[model samples]
Target chain A: MASVLASAHPQETVYGQVGDATVPLRFSSLDEEYKVLRERAAVLDLGGHGLIEITGPDAVAFAQRVLARDVEYLTSDRCMMTLLLDADGQVVDQVLAFGREDGILLESSCGAGARLLAHLRANNDEGVEIADRSGDLTVLGLEGPYAWGVVGRLIDGELASLPFESVVDTTWNGADIVFARTGFTGEYGYQMIVPIEHAADLWRQSLEHAQAAGQEALELAMLEVRQPIPRHEVTEGATVVEIGANWLVDVTKDEFVGREAVLAAFEAGGGRRTVGFSGGDGVPAPGTRVWVNGQDIGEVVHAVHSVGLGATLGLARVDHDLAAAGLELTVGGTEVTTLTSPYIVPKSWSIPII
Target chain B: MTIDELRARAAERQQTCSQIKKMIVSRLDLEIDPDWITDDQPLFGRGLELDSLDVLELYVAIEAEFGVALYDSEMAVFGSVSRLAEEVNPALRA
Candidate 1:
């Protein structure tokens, strides 16, 4: 699926196939876009992300059973990021779930909407109404240390400070839209779920305040903050514990789809844990062997040349005993040092919303 | 470092991270096991879903538990358990 606003994109836009959707990989260059995302603000065409709506009386109940996190008290004005897991506790997709007055709206990770919709429909024993709302609604994002400023200029100033995970039903160009303080890159981020007809206008207006960034830059910034990227990190048979996404699972919930398997994995323990590493000559591909001296401990799960770090940043699923940061590990033939999470401290952490 | 030496170093950071995790869980009264919180999982905004108030509580908890005051430190200090481990136990830092 191509972005709904692709017609408005620049002629120089570079696009790539990512699963079910064809997405812009970069507008100018990855480095330029990445710098904008971290230092200033970058507008994102998140049309590749699927928006699925679940309604009817059992909407919340059905959502409660399907979502890995506790959303029982998730009010209409709030949204939270959680994982949709299969029976085996393997991730289906990481989603931003918005609580709507009628039911719940889920924004699937870029290019994973179809799979998420299928997973939800297959498990919908509660007979709730499931609809793929992507045709009618699409997502746009603004992220960076100064993304809050763009939010104020583009929409409402108050919405910029709506607290993290907070959502509001509002308008843009007189079109009913849902605005949420959602982020992927650990920066001051906000998402606008607008009607398809009004998406192009919002995207253009946003461009005036922020430069456009594509999927590559967005994913790179997310990696820097150690945000779980399901596409890159969720390898086959990799348990949530091994993926280091335990926080996305609500083990405390009495019953949820993958709770049993996730709990079992956690109790089983001693699985390979994922850690961040840097300082490699080239980006290592997934499954590249990670070595500690002569011992083959694990493999690279995901990696990229981080523009922020000016080095190759990657995650290795190493044995639990050797997963901590500040260790010298070899990936393939190049030596890399496992570093602390948030490999690049997000400037948003220090910048407050004014 | 050699394999054994690297293992020892990794173990040292892991121990400190474990202590920090335990302190966070205990102080915040979280229900999950401290070990469940991975060394690399984010601690605020997205991962653990900690808020500013939680940070305030953690500030006191960290000083009491580690005998190190983080009152003046930037919010980046709590980026993750491993990051916090570095601040609480400076020896764990690279």
Candidate 2:
């Protein structure tokens, strides 16, 4: 189904594997897409992300036992970021769990659907039903400071007052669509989920609306800059604490899988910490070794030349001691100054005072 | 101020420090005991080993607990429990 959207950029699009599907990588120049996403608004195809639906009476209770967040406390009108972990506290998949009226919907990496479903079923206490809806659902990502305006124009209800991570259901031309005030681009954005039949039409309509409204379409690469921590770093053998996502883990919760392991790691002090670096001579490719004091400390997980920040930014999992900002580290033999994540703050989302 | 008044003021400051220390421990989900947090021990780097994210969480927790807002520029106040007490006590009094 995403191939329909990918077809639009036939000449300029590059294909990349995201989970089980090959989605459009770049519709145009990376820099242009980055600029559109930063300065204005842009639409992105998030069709590659897997969507899973869990229903029945035990759905929420079962999820609360498996996921690493306070799933039981999640309100039906909102969504929360959660992590699936192995018994050893290693991250399996990062997911956004949306509490729905009927059940819970989980959006995760494409390839993780089967595994996640299997894990859920193995622990299922009966009266629970889980189904992979990735093939039936298509997600469109609208991001930037002006993204809310684009979404506000399409939906019938008022979205201006909606808080982040809140989900609202609406219809477009008789097609059922769900818009969630959530995104990975560190901007005020929405991820719209529509039925597969309406996917192509909705994608085209969203693009047409943005274009008519004088906004540009962004490629998926724009996500590289806005991500607080790249997905690979979190999924590849990095614990939640090591990635500085301790806030996501509810240690007070009773008996979630990997809770004990995570608690132990936190107590014993987790290993390498993920930190951001910038002002480098060039963009250090992923897996580039990071050197400190002539010693190999760690390697870069992801790096890109950020047009918005006007510097080559990279996220690296380095020694915990060197994770502090303003430290100088050598990445791919070029000196880079370490800085914190969200190098460029979005104009739309403001940090709440309380 | 009189000697008794000075003693009472010192006691109030000490109570604030303990409250802040407990908040940090509970909020960050740290394993360390609140009693281990000395008044002068640095919250970041060598002392508590808290990184930038921890500082942000601590700021939010402090605001939620004490109704005192900590600005990004005033991060140095988080350098020690005593400093946090100094910042939070006035707000609590107010």
- Note the clash tally of each candidate: 0, 1
Would you list the clashing residue pairs of candidate 1? none
Candidate 1 regions with alpha-carbon error over 4 angstroms: none
What does candidate 1's lDDT look like per residue over B1-94, in tens digits? 7888887998898888889888888989999889888888888888888998999999999889889999999988988888888999998865
**Each model's fraction of native contacts:** 0.94, 0.00
Q: How many Å off is the CA of A143 in candidate 1? A: 0.5
Question: How high is the lDDT of residue A148 in model 2?
Answer: 72
Candidate 2 stretches greater than 4 Å from native? A1-4, A7-11, A125-127, A211-230, A350-354, B1-94
Best by lDDT: 1
Q: Model 2: per-residue lDDT, tens digit, A35-70?
A: 667666778777767788889888888888789877
Error of 1 at A189 (Å): 0.3
